[model samples]
Structures are given as structure tokens and as C-alpha cells.
Target chain A: MKIAFTTKGREWQSEMEPRFGRTDYILIYDEDKDTLIIFDNCEAKSHEHGAGPTVAKILIENGVNVLITGNGPGGNAIEVLKKSSIEVYSGAIEMSVKEAYDKYKNKKLPRF
Target chain B: MKIAIASGKGGTGKTTLSVNLASLLAQKNSVFLVDLDVEEPNAKLFLAGELLSEEPKYKMIPKWSEESCTFCQKCVEVCNYHALLGIANEILVFPNLCHSCYACSELCPTQSLPMFAQKMGTARHYVMPDMELIEGELDLGEEQAVSLISQTKTYVDKLLLKDTIAIYDCPPGTSCPVIEAVKDVDFVILVTEPTPFGLNDLKLAVETMRVLKKPFGVVVNRYDAQDDRVFAYCESENIEILAKIPNDKALAVLYSKGALIYHSSKSVKCELEKISCFLKSLTCKERA
Candidate 1:
């Protein structure tokens, strides 16, 4: 299973972004490979109207089964995620990537 | 000739200037007052007339046909707004983000993405005693305003005469909607107050007009003779101060009652006459 976390850095301890669409980086954790890969998502800054749809498309293309994010993906992003198999778990704002991942593993994170 | 009355900040009397000017000018000349502020068109509220016609406006959004799809991801790649997404066996189109540019639909190799009309707003035509009023009202939750404003302008253009003057009451701010509203106008009248926020937004509006290379000026609304920031800015920028509508409780009371202050308030009438002269000068320049 693959899981994604919106992060501020490439490290596991990097702070998770408080917003989903405009996150600076996206970190994917692969359970099968027991490895972590990071993708640059700084293009969200330049998006004027809708940033959620494209960003959600990235998570879908990367085969993310679960997502831990913050305040939004907005409505347009939510539309894309709704059609995918990715389960959304929010309320990860202000937490480190590792902490959010741990909370997800422990079933302490709220699922949306 | 077309003139758009715009303001960067809201509640600075764009509609007041538009309504009074249109009412006054329509007495001796043919005039069309179009409320391009689709999100909240209040120009119609101040003008009474029969609803000659009302029609729904549409925006061309893409409809994905799965039968003709090869999953080539061409639609997703061509969309500048990123409104389309291609996944395993399915393609998604987010209508909210779509700009209706037809780039994706036209570029699709298999005709998988076809343009479909989606209702975005309604355009109403009102015939006042001497002038005609046209306004576009955007549907609730509509994400963008440029398309509606453009469609309304096209509708108004068809009904305009060669000598008819067009006055557009534009939406506030210096954004895309405002840009589209003032795009083809011959002149722009930016209404602003004398406060810090008003001056700040006025500067942004001035920059937008400069970038568009349009002949424009400012009209100081609710003129506080004590404050000199707006006057100083206009003078320093070499911008003409077209008219000043003085601050008065009597004008405010009449405006609140949806009364045309052009006939009710003498001070406001004088300001409208000054704006009228400016419009006349523009016509003279065109003739010369």
C-alpha cells in the first residue's frame, strides 16, 4: 500500500503542510518497498484559481491509497479524490510527517 | 462610444455614477447602461423599466465521452486551467476550473472531449422611458465572472446604435472580471474615495488601465474636501479628475431610496454634467 503526506521538506520529520493544494512537497511512503520518495509540488504557488484538481491528479497518478493532509483540497480537488480509491484522512496540520504517519498507523487521525 | 465606470474598492458609488449619468444623457441622446457587475448587478435596482427580454447565458464546458476514449491523456495535457484529469480507465473534468478555452476539446484526437453549453447566468434587457438598461446576473456559486461579462457585452453590442452612448457599471477590483468589463471601452471612469484603502486600490486600478493602454480618469465619490491624498495622487500621475460628487446626507438618503440623484440633488447633478462634458469631448475627438 502507498500513502502520501503533504510535507514541507524531503525528510521524514519534515512538517506537514497546513494546506493541501499549495503544499511545497509531496512525500509518498511505500509499505511494500519500505521506502520514502518525495516529489516537488512548488507549482501550487503559481496556481491562481484551482490548484486542487492537478495536485490531486498527482496523488492519483502516483498510486496513493491513502492521503494525510491539512485544511483542504478545496471542492475541485475533492471531486478528483472522490472518484479515486484514495482514502482521505485530514487534521494533520502543524504535525511532522512522521508524526502524522504514526497517527495514521495508530488510527488516531480523523478520516474524511 | 463606450465608457465604463469602475472602482477598485466596493461601495464607492460606481452604480450611482453610472445610473445618474445614463439617466441624464439618455434624455437628449440614446444611451445603453449595462451593468457588467454580474456577481451583484445593482444598476437595475435604481432604474425602472419593463423587462423586454431575459435569456440564460452559457459557458462552453467540456464533456468527456468514454466511448471514444483511448486514454491518450491528450485532454489533460492541453487544458491550461488543469480542469481535466486522466486516470486508469476514466477521465474527469472539473467544471469549476474550466475556463472554456476549447483548447482541450479542439486538440483531442478522437473527439473524446466535446464542448457542451452549461448555464452560468441570465441576461436581462430593460427598456426605460428614454434609455435601455442591460444587466447580467451570475448564478450563485459561479466561480468566474469574465465569461458572463463578455457574453453580456456581446449582447449589448448587437443592440447598440452608431451614435448611442454605452455606459458600463463594472464590477469592483482590478481582477480579470474588471479587465474584461473595461476591455473594449473607449474610456474608463474610476470612482474612488479619499481614504487610504480607496487610494491603495485606486492605484492598482490605475495600473491596470495603464497596462491596457486605455484613456482613463478618476471621479472622487463621497468627496471629503479635507482629504487630499486622492487629488494629490491624480495630479502627480497627471491623471484628470473628471468629477467630484460631494458628501451629503441628502444625496445618501435619496440614493438609499433608489432615487436618481441627478434630479433630486443639485450638487450631484452638477457633477453628472461635468462627466457629460467629458463624454462629449471624447466624441468630438473621435469626429475630429
Candidate 2:
């Protein structure tokens, strides 16, 4: 699985790689299994004043399969993501990357 | 014209300067004091006001139908965000995970997907005797503060009944929220203190402002007893120094008690008045 995660804040960089607790969003690809591995989108950058669209735009362009993070997306932004195949998990901020990914694997997390 | 007061790091007296400056500006021009720091809105604490109205808003997510889903896995394949989960017999939809692109619905051969709206947050607007205060409160545990701030601005535009100036207290950091608050503004006031952390964050904020192509000046908070490094940096960068508020323990004591420092100290008020004048002149020059 090829997984990419965005750091939440600079301070959490050290802990993010080891446990998946630091980054704001995690994108995972399960190639051989033929199953998509998704985490959450928690990238802290989107919290900026005018950055919702910009961040969502980047995630879609990058081909992120699953974004495990904490953020309630904007209205128009939701439309853009639905078109782009990017899913956002808004209440995943407090959940560690591992926990979020595990839930996705088990189909325990509810859809927004 | 609208002016945003921002600090890169937290606890840098942004609210203090914003409140005083807005009060002073309100004396001559009707000023709208907007608290863009939705996460921790503190401007109303200094200004006396009552809740006027709050409107709830939301973002949309896609709803999928499993009855017609053929398990082609196309939706899953196309979804880079993994918002859709397709099983042999069922397809699950995660609304919080949905960015609302409608790609799944667009790509679905059976057209089994549709969009549904969900609450995002509430923006509160309060009317004070002298000025209006507006705040965007993202629902607790919500992540998209930037969007709420953008919506709040439109609401503010509707409330502008006459010609008035605006003083926006922007959030900390140089990320999306900060950019949204400062964007399209006439000018920005970057507030900082005299410390290593202060200087570092100031640089980040300044870089962000430059990237956004906004005219900005520096205001050194707590200048009476600090090193000259901040001043030196401003001089080298040719960034204009707006005004400096001295570090007064008396003022600090007043602030600790939930009172505005500017009201307790005439010197502080005078300093902010000077800054207000400087800002007006610069804005005039920019307009010319």
C-alpha cells in the first residue's frame, strides 16, 4: 500500500510517521489487493481563512483515495470534491491515523 | 476600506490592538469590528454587545444508492478521496468524508448517487451601540474554518447599511484561515512582539502577506522594554512601522481583569490613535 499523510502542525511531525497521529490527511492505495485503503483528511492547512478550496483542489489533483482528517468542508467545496472523487472525514481530527484507517478497514466508521 | 489585524503566533496581543484601533476609528467613521478568529473569538469580550442574530450554514455530501449499484467499483476507483465504499452487495456513503464533487454520481453508470446537505456552522452578528461585531463559529469538532470565515464576510457585506470602515481581527498562523481573512482587504497590520518566537512568526506572516500581494506594515507590541531586533528587521526589509504599545504592568493588570488595556491607560489609547492616523494616511496614499 502506498500511503501519504499531511502533517497537522509542525510540532507533530516527529510523531506522525511513527503512529499516524500528526498529519492532517492520510491517502493510502492498496494496489495488489484491489481494494482502496482510506484514512482521513486532517491537514491543518485548510483551516486558514481562504484555503478550503485550494486545499480540496490539491487533494483531488493528487489522486488521494482517502482523506482522514478533521474538518467540516465548505458548501461549494463539497461539490468540487464530489466531482473530484475526494472524500473528507470531518470528525477525524482527534482520531489517530491508525485508528481511522483501522475503522475504514473494518467498515466501522459511518458515512457523513 | 477593510483592514485586517493579524499575528503569526498566538498570545501576541492581536485582539488588544484590534479593539483599541477599532474604537478609535469609530469616533470619526462608522467601524465594523469583525472577529475572524472563529475558533476563539474574543473581540466581543472587550466590546459591550448583545447577540443580534445567528444563521446556520452547511456543506453538501453525496448520497449513493446501493439498490442499483452493480459493484463495478468505478466509483471507488475514480474517488481519490475514498469517500465511497463499494461491496459485493452494498455501497456505503460517508458524508463527512465526501468533498461533494459529484464525480461518483457523474461516473456511476446507473446514476445511483445524489447529493445531500449538512450543517457546517453558525455565523453570529451582534450590534453594539457604536459598532457591529461579527463572528464565525465553526461547529465544535468541525475542520473547515476557512469556509465559515468566507461565508461570514458575505453576511457582513449585507449588513453594511452606509459607508463605513472595518477592522477585522484575523486568526493566528499564516494558513488558509489567515489568507481568507486578509484577502481582498485594503491593508493589513501584522502585530508582533520583541522575542525570537515573535520574530520568527512575524516572518512567516509577512511572507504569507507578500504571497497574497497585500500591502502590510508592522506593529511592535510591548516596545517599552524589549530588544531592538524587531525594529532592525523592519528597517532592513523596508516594512513600515505603524506604532508600538509599551509594556506596562499596569496595563497588563487591567487586561488580566477582563478590562481593555487601552481604556485604563491614556498612553495606550494615544499610541493606537497614532497608528489609526498612520493607517489612514497610508490607505489614502495607496488609493491615490
Candidate 3:
């Protein structure tokens, strides 16, 4: 399964970003292979409107099955992700991507 | 000739200037005053005229026929607004998110998606003996402001007489709605106040008008010579200062009572007449 975390920086040690759509980077972790892929979310930065669904589409195309972030996705993004059966978990603020993944694995994060 | 009255900041008296200028110009020429501030239209409050007609405006949105849809997701791919979602063997449509571009139906291979019009707002027509007012009012929670503005302009275009002067009372800010209101006009009158905020927004509005390549002049509303920033900027830019309306308590009281200050105040009437004369000179030049 592929899990994605919204992060302020590209590395795994970077703190989790509170925003889902406008986050600076996205850290995707492959749970089966134990590998991580960092994606720069610079395209969404200049979006004046509809950034949420645009970011959600990017994550969906990347084969992300789960999303772990500090804040909840917007209403439009939630609708898109829910339609694709992607699970979204919250409560990752101030934590690293690894820590957020671990919390999700242990069922400690709240589902939004 | 068409003139658009615009301001980058809200409450800078765009409507006040629009109504007064239109009233002054209508004394001799045929004038059509269009209130394009669909979100919060207040020009109607000050203009007293018999309501002639109200026509609802509609925008075309796509509707899919489930039985004929092959679930190819072509419409979803073409939809830039994310209004269409293709789920497990089914497609979902969000009407509010649609921009009425009709791209989805155009791209549908099977032609299952059909186009339909949705009611967005109303265009109202009010007429006095000399001047006519056409205003667009968007329905609450509707997001298609540009479409309604364009529709109102189209309606006014058909009714306009030859050599008539049309004045558009535009909305605030240099956003899409403001562009729609001011685009393709003969001239733009930028109404601004005398303050730091006013100067900043005036710069923005000037930049927008420059990009639009329209002839524009500045009007300093509530002008106080004590704060010379507005005048200084206009002088440095070499832009024309058409008129200066002095800040007065009586003007505020009259505005609050939805009254036209030109009707009771001689000084304001003279200033607006000066603006009307300037605009008339432009029209004369255009004719010559």
C-alpha cells in the first residue's frame, strides 16, 4: 500500500505540514517495500483557487491509497478521495513523515 | 461611447460617481447606466425610476444520460473545474462547481453528455424620462458572476441607440468580475479616495486599466488636499485628474439616505458636470 504525508520539507525528518492542498512537499511511503518517494508540490502553490482537488488528483495519479496529514482535506478533495476509496488520516502536526506513518500503522491517527 | 466607473477598493463611491455622472450626461444625450456589481448592487438604491422589466439570465451546464454513457471518463478528463467524477461504473456531477464551459459535452465521445441552461441571475431594466438603468443581480451563493455580467452587457448592447453614452458601474478589486465589467469599454473612470489604502488600490486599478489598454482618468473622491499622495502619484504618472470631490459630512448623510447629492448640493453638481463635460469632449473627439 502507498501512504502519503503532507510535509513542509522533502525529507522524511521534515515536519508534517498542516495544509493538505498547499503543502510544500508530499512524502509517499511504500509500506510493502519500505521505500519513500518525495514529491515537490510547487505547482499547487500558485493556484488561486481549486488547489485541493488538483493536489488530490496528483496524489491519486501517484497511486496513493492513504493520506496522512495534519489538517483535513477540503470538501472537494474529500469527495474525490472518498470516491477513489482512499483513506485519509489526520493528526500529524509537528511530527515527521516516519512518525506519522507509524501512528497510522498503530491506528493512533484520527480518520477524517 | 461606453464609460466604466471602477475602483480597486470597496466603498470608494463607484456607484455614487456613476449615478451622478449618468444623470448629468442624460440631460442632453441618451445614457444607459449599467450596474455590473452583481454581488452587491447598490446603484438601484439611489436611482429612482419605474421598473420596466426583469429577465433571468441562464448559463449552460452539462447533463449526462446514464443509459448512453460508456463510462469512458472523457468528460471527467476534460472538466477543469473537477465538476465531474467517474466512480465505479458511474459518473457524478457537481453543478455548483461547473463553470459552464461546455467542454465536457464537447469532449464526450459517446455524446451522452447533453448541455442545459441553469438560472444564475436576473437582469433588470428601469427607466426614467431621460436615462435608462440596466443592472445585473446574481442569485445568492451563485459563483458565475462573469457570465451574468457578460449577459447584462449583451442585453444592453441590443437596446443601445446610436451615439448613446453607456456608463458601467463596475465592482471593486482588479479581479475577473472587474475585468468583465470594464473590458472593451470606450473609457474607464477610476474612482479612488485619498489615503494609503486608496493609493495602493489605485495603483492596482491603474495597472489593470493599462493592461486592458483603455483610456482612463482618475477621480479623487473625498479628496483632501492635506493628503497629497493621490495627487502626487497621478501627477508623476502624467494621468489626468478629471475631478476632485471634497470630503463632506453632508455628503455622507445624503448617501446614507440613498439620495443623489447632485440633486441638493451645488458644489457636487458642478464637479459631476465637469466630469460629464470631460466625457462629452471625449465623445466629440471620437465623432470628429
Compare the candidates by DockQ and give the number of the best one. 1
Order the candidates by lDDT, highest first — what do you get? Answer: 1, 3, 2
lDDT winner: 1
Task: State which docking tier applies to candidate 3.
Answer: acceptable
lDDT of 2 by residue, B174-205 (tens): 98789999997889999999988899999999
lDDT of 1 at A14: 95
User: What are the runs in model 3 whose C-alpha is more than 4 Å off?
Assistant: A1-3, A29-35, A44-48, A58-66, A85-112, B66-97, B128-130
> TM-score (0 to 1) for chain A, all models?
0.95, 0.55, 0.94
Please write out the lDDT profile of model 3 over residues A31-107, one tens digit for every residue: 89988898888886666655677678778778989999988898877876776778899889988877887788899
lDDT of 1 by residue, B132-241 (tens): 99999999999779999999999999989999999999999999999999999999999999999899999999999999999999999989778899999999999999
What order do candidates take by TM-score, descending?
Answer: 1, 3, 2
Q: Of the pair 1 and 2, which is ahead by DockQ?
A: 1
Which window of 10 residues has the lowest lDDT sum in candidate 3 chain A? A44-53
Q: Which stretches of candidate 2 lie over 4 Å from their true place?
A: A1-18, A21-112, B68-113
Interface RMSD of each: 1.5, 10.5, 3.0
Cα lDDT of all candidates, in order? 0.91, 0.72, 0.88
User: Candidate 1 regions off by >4 Å?
Assistant: A31-34, A102-108
* Winning candidate number (TM-score): 1
TM-score of 2: 0.69
Model 2 Cα interface RMS deviation (Å) = 10.5
Candidate 2 or 1, higher lDDT: 1
